[model samples]
Target: MYKSLLVTGVCAGLLAGPAFAQPYGYDDGNDRPEYARVIRTQPVYQSVRVDEPRQECWDEPVSYADPRYQNNVTAGGLIGAIAGGVIGNQFGGGAGRVAATALGAVVGANVGAGAAAANTPYVAHEGYEQRCRVVPNSHVEDRVIGYDVTYRYGGRSYTTRLPYDPGDHIAVDVDVQPRAY
Candidate 1:
């Protein structure tokens, strides 16, 4: 009888040891998996203000005249004076010719200067300049960061925010714990 009682006790202990050593929630009957009906799922959005930098470019026309042609004015006046004096020397006699030559030289110098200014070559340099500025193009965008889920579980309504949509039903963890009064 003592040997039989020892065998029965050993068998009972072996069965109970596994039940006690099991993990807290698995098959322990207190914690299990259940589903909650999703009543409404509203997408939670975040207002994001984005600033995108873009390069906007356009061509601007630029032009300038070369300054090397300015020396022609003096050369033109001297040439005109010599031509005028020769023409005047052929006109009058003696002192009159001298007076005429002086007047003609003066008139020729003035005319030559004027002609040189008008005939100067204007070297125009035409080109385009690319100018740019950083413009802040901003716009507000609504991004769905999460979902506001309203669900009914065990005849009670609860609201929670989830990172993804749970469709019509959401799997929930049901943990039953003794109330501490």
Candidate 2:
């Protein structure tokens, strides 16, 4: 009877061994680390626009002319007529001298008026003014944002995006579990 009991106990222990090895809802922290072969790699890029501020400057010409002396000739005409009448009195005889003096005064007044108009000096001012403006220079550039990696593990292919290049091989975590069905 004792031998039969021992045999039954051994059979029960054997049946329960698999159940204790893998509990239904427990983790033993037994994830295995393995390597996966890299199938292909491609670089991912992003387009970005950059704006830089710059100052643009140029010189503009400015000029001004005085308007006070533009059209006044009264003083010069009166002075010229008086001088012409004296010179004409010295040039001809009695009656002829009087006629010559009148003619000379008229001619001199006209000449003096024209001379005053032509000789008036105009006051001019010349200078430059500096003008400036701010302009934005913009340009577009392509930047590498990340890398797309394709790898093969356990006869299956997978693709993932990573921040850096994972050379020829990548480390993978493997965990074994029983199916729920």
Candidate 3:
């Protein structure tokens, strides 16, 4: 009985390994990018007050930082295939079982692909905000002189101005980034 239990555990591990693993890559820390966009030219709002030095928020590059979780495509595929095969094989018997297993794998692959595609990319919009600060790369002054503000949301990038001077910290609304797995 103990040996059978051990075998079952091993088989389960092999079959369920993918489910236990994570399926996406996302930032773990909730912090602003290392760099911020400095206001270069103004189309509206005229000149920015230098005295109101506020921290600028800028979108960091994709690789600027790593994600919290790594995409487990392999694991997801394996899990889907196993689950699909088991479910598909239930109705079929003998020769039919083999056919069912094959069908299950195909269905599983599709399901896995669909699941991966469901994962969304980054997003920015109104209502939602992203807090940001000055990047270390800035060599201008001790305080933020200005920021190149172009807030984008719902597929629209709207250039705007800072209502208040950015201090040591500031909160800029950002769209929720989708998970990538």
Per TM-score, the best of the predicted structures is: 1
TM-score for each candidate, following the candidate numbering: 0.49, 0.43, 0.27
Q: Candidate 1, residue 177: CA error in Å?
A: 1.6
Error of 3 at 68 (Å): 7.8
User: lDDT order of candidates, best first?
Assistant: 1, 2, 3
Q: Is candidate 1 or candidate 3 better by TM-score?
A: 1
Q: Per-residue CA lDDT of candidate 1, range 1-86, in tens?
A: 99999999999999999777954333356555778899999999999998898878888999866655556877788988988888
lDDT digits (tens) for residues 1-181 of candidate 3: 9999999999999999988874232234666533233333333334433444457776543332113122444455677888888888887789999999899988896787566545633233334345588644323234444454554333444554664444333344444576999
- Candidate 3 TM-score, true structure as reference: 0.27
Give the worst 10-residue stretch by lDDT in candidate 1: 22-31
Q: Candidate 3: worst 10 consecutive residues by lDDT?
A: 61-70
Cα error of candidate 1 at position 107, Å: 34
True-vs-predicted CA distance for residue 39, candidate 1, Å: 1.0
Model 1 pairs in collision:
none
TM-score-wise, the better of 2 and 3 is 2
Model 1: residues with Cα > 4 Å off, grouped in runs: 1-32, 64-122
lDDT of candidates 1 onward, in order:
0.85, 0.82, 0.57
Candidate 2, residue 52: lDDT: 87
